[model samples]
Target: MNNTETPSFEEWVHYCFTQGYSDFHTEPDADHYEAHEQRRQRFVDIDPKALSEHIIRLFSNPAFLADEYTDQQIADAVWFIFGLATTYFLHLRSEVVPRNVQIRCIESVATLYTDLFDRLCDKHDVDPNKSSSKDTPLEDAVYMIWDMDCIEGAVMFPKHWPHLVDPGFRVLETILEKCRTVTCKESALHALGHIHMYHPERVEKIIDKFLASPDQPGVLREYALDAREGAVQ
Candidate 1:
């Protein structure tokens, strides 16, 4: 495509996957890689909000959630969403895209990743603590969930959308109750702490329960204590 031509949704997805923006492997030389980068920059420069909207639409497509793409491709796409939205929030501060649109985009991506992670866990019986063979699908999905939780805590928390925050709280609660991996549990706790920042009364009840329950992990208890301390300070 010429520089003057804007990439269609399909073309953009293909380009993102091929250019190492998505997790799929591509080994282009310096010139080819630079060309792809320039194209992507142009896409952003021309209309970053339009590009962002297209990405959200592409992700919302039912085919995306189906088995149409390889697991790696889906993971890559989810990670790409996180990278793009976070960078946009930091650099442009939602000037191009309306803040609400940016917030929804990030929320949708997080929800999608959470769904994908849950499916992977059920299908593979993922044990987060155990070492898996390199590049395994289960491993990738677990890592993706952890990364999503990190972003949710660090970025999404401040957006303070009640709809998203409520659902996110439920998801994190499920992770704490069902997930056995230390990393996943810790990530969930961190996310819960962030959510607590805005909805302190609601989150405080959950934290209190966790602290009082003998069945809960000690690490989780410590996290709850820390979150409470942070809240007061």
Candidate 2:
């Protein structure tokens, strides 16, 4: 209940399962789901609102996590938190969650995410940029898309949508649209996503439109589509 008193991992999971399965979610990784299932069931049938309030209170505390949680644990928890919050209050419920609330939520998870990343980087004894691994549950579902207003859900490419990662074009577009930092957006757009959805045409179009851009942002030419070879220019 208090910030200094963290919950056990088992407690956090029980809290969620008691609330009921996430209303708007893809299945979590098998291992992650299995781990949570080991905890007490949170919701077979219960008041969604009360459960949501309980969830909010639980995670709001800095001490909400189990000491042994890894990046995966933090990532999963973040997704569940957002999913529960949006389903019960934001999105179809209300469009706006104040900035202060949003900032606090993000800051709460920052340490964990950063720690996870640090651990991985350390294990490999390499810089994150040098690390070959390209994906994390946090990047796609948590950090990249988390915004104060919940204006858009997680902005990173879906694993199923490998094309979205193409040349970092659409990925950048996604970031700029859903993400907050300009530097990070640019980095993601130009470098990070080089595998699939790389559309240069869309980039041209976006650049042209934004040359005199007003505000809301614009999408480029071959973006979201294949613009390659002769099609690129």
Candidate 3:
């Protein structure tokens, strides 16, 4: 592609996976994060809805279906999508558009994210309903997206606004109930706490249940307590 030409969604995805951005950024080396943000700006002009659709289409592509790409590469690409989509919706929220219009645009992109999540699970053979301690690439990708989109992305809705983001409250509730991983639960609780002022009753009820559950680990309960304290503070 020429320098002046806008990279197609597929091209950008390929660049993200094949280039340096997909590599894990060990802390103290913030270059990877900066690289990701810089590359993401390349397609800032593309409609988020369109970009999300391109991601969905990627699963069925001949190259993706063939044994050409490793699971790690695919996971890395999807990770990039989560960050990019988050940027898009956050931008939408900041726009001067009517509230309903902003919600509509966000909903469209959010729905695509939900679709993309399911496709990744099915195609990559990761079971979203089951929690495992395994650090396999596909599993990590699925859970990361779940945490990023459903948990973090959900709480980011404007204060006192109804939960309109796809993969929002309902999905997070499911993750809390079904996913046995403590780290995942901690992240979910932390996110809920972050939004607690806007969703006090719901957040408190869920965290209360988690704290009361005998099966939950002590560390998780402590995290929950800290989250509650943070919320009130």
Candidate 4:
């Protein structure tokens, strides 16, 4: 996210680290995504229970606790991850876990900071249950988590948060509202370049908002329009 010329595994892992999932660092790379069978093969090997349990321990462990991270940051990491782990484990798990011990473990961590995210969601009139809560569908909830208000507070303690970049275009395309403050505007602006396609009607309003807003840098504005207009011919 900070401006790297050539992307690499290390870079992607670092970006996702901010989002609090460094475990994905071990996932296969470009060679793995070259074909559908190759992609599906990766999923075939995972034992959701083992993977989920390992993830919980890694984030919870004090030593793996990023030295630069504040206790508050670490706490938020737990909260955000609890939600993600719940979503991925419960509904998305193709094979059900008999007991799902991971859910119980995640709930314990949720006690520390779910209240904070709930409050954040409240300010926006988004019901934690319906809008951005951990229980909400991940696709709809992403905007709430990556929101401008939440990002600074999260990344503040994680100076090395890099894993945050991998979800770029997919998240932006579905983000609820493109009308955002300067803080979030940059991310959406940057993500536009990576967009495959956007619904014409929905994107027009986003473009209008960008054009009307006074806060963006000139270059960002240029990219915004170019993104809407399809690569400047």
Candidate 5:
């Protein structure tokens, strides 16, 4: 892909969907790091607002299909874009993207999750509370709700813009209540902890529920315990 020319909406989605997925089982060598950096550099010139608009359009249109792509491929693409958006909003290129544009990108991510849940739960009649292989797009999307690296942004977005994160919080709560996957629930707990300072009571209530639940996974319970103490995971 050419770094100078901005990709069209379809082209952008296609590119993300096609990128080789890496599990990072071993430490990446110099060549791996260089290739990853080059992939990231390809998006430097694309306007954040435009990127977000395409994301919104891609998820909003039920008719705009990605049938050719496997669920795993689509999920991998979701991970890539979420990492890109979070990196821009919380780490690099904040000046270039602007606060409002960051908000727009966040809303796009929220929309992606919403659309995934609707398709998975409402349309396909899949149970959100049941644990699966977690290779599906919806499960993968849920795992990205929190930035485990402590660069959390979704729940903290409300620090500057209060009501903007309400929907996001609701989504996280729903995930915590209904998602049975240990890592996905852990991500939700950590994401909710980001706003513990502003809404301690609400966050505490959610964490308490998780802790009190029967047969809770050890790792997930540990995360909830940490969130109860307002510890960043």
Candidate 6:
């Protein structure tokens, strides 16, 4: 594995589908974790910005806009980016990466998530106006929820990054109000609960409105209650 090499689109897909998948499953033990960290560090050790830019470039390629790529190819690409985004979060949490680099990485992950969400919606012909349509895949919603979870985790760190807080709230709130999947909604609620720990007053009204809605799902209602409890504690 040439750490300095920039993989072509097909090469990236193959690498992610093979080596990257195995890399993601490395255990948390000291030896395995260090090895995993070394692999990730290769991408970021010199230019922390390069890895994220490469991921974004792969995602924005013209092939995705055409019908040439199979659905499996697109899904694999997303999984690859998701795995990298998870690594980015680990880097941020460990505080090993420079603060400026960490911020750019955060924005990059958010951009990737938003781009993926819009692309998936366009592919599926999801109409924002029609809330009742079940045409959207649950996996698509899960992707967006995972993105929010990433942002939520970042905000929970002891050192606050003012730039991400509002955007995180907006994304979570959008998922809470508009997403049809119960699992996604529940994930959003839980992320909100974590966010509420830092900014209780900011989230109080939103949780109250969720609790007030009779049409809300039971799981969501339960999450809202838990968030409210967490806020007061």
**Whole-model Cα lDDT of every candidate shown, in order:** 0.52, 0.37, 0.51, 0.37, 0.56, 0.52
Whole-model alpha-carbon lDDT for candidate 2: 0.37
Which runs of model 4 end up more than 4 angstroms from their true locations? 1-184, 196-198
- Backbone clashes per model, in order? 0, 17, 0, 9, 0, 0
Can you write out model 5's per-residue Cα lDDT over 182-225, one digit (the tens) per residue?
Answer: 54565677676666876788789878877788778666666677
User: Could you tell which candidate, 4 or 5, scores higher by TM-score?
Assistant: 5
Model 5 pairs in collision: none
Off by over 4 Å in 2: 1-66, 83-122, 131-233
Tell me each candidate's TM-score: 0.57, 0.33, 0.52, 0.30, 0.58, 0.55
A best-first ranking of the candidates according to their TM-score comes to 5, 1, 6, 3, 2, 4
Candidate 6 lDDT over 97-128, as tens digits, reads 55555555554543433444333433444333
Task: Report model 2's TM-score to 2 decimal places.
Answer: 0.33
- Give one digit per residue, the lDDT tens place, for model 3 in 1-233: 43434567667556656653334343325655665555545554445445445544553242443255566776665465455543544444443544555444434433333333333333434343433323466546554553454325545554534435433555556556765554355445656666566666777777887777788766667667776655422
Per-candidate alpha-carbon RMSD to the true structure:
6.1, 12.0, 7.6, 16.5, 6.3, 7.2
Model 1 lDDT per residue over 1-233, tens place: 56746678776666554443532235557768776556656544446676667656764543554465666765565455445422432332336666566555544544443444444433455344343322455444444443453345433554543334554566566665665554445545565565565667777776777667676655456666776544321
Backbone clashes counted, model 6: 0
- For residue 223, model 3's alpha carbon misses the true position, in angstroms, by 0.5
- Using TM-score as the measure, which candidate wins? 5
For model 2, give the 10-residue run with minimal summed lDDT. 224-233
> What lDDT is obtained when candidate 6 is compared to the true structure?
0.52
Residues 1-233 of candidate 2: C-alpha lDDT, one tens digit per residue:
33223345455455543332343244557767754443223332223444344543554453434454555555555555555443432321222443344333333333333333323322433232332223455344443333322312222333422322232244344444543332233323333223223344555465444334344222322222222222221
Which candidate do you rate higher for TM-score, 4 or 6?
6
Better of 1 and 3 by TM-score: 1
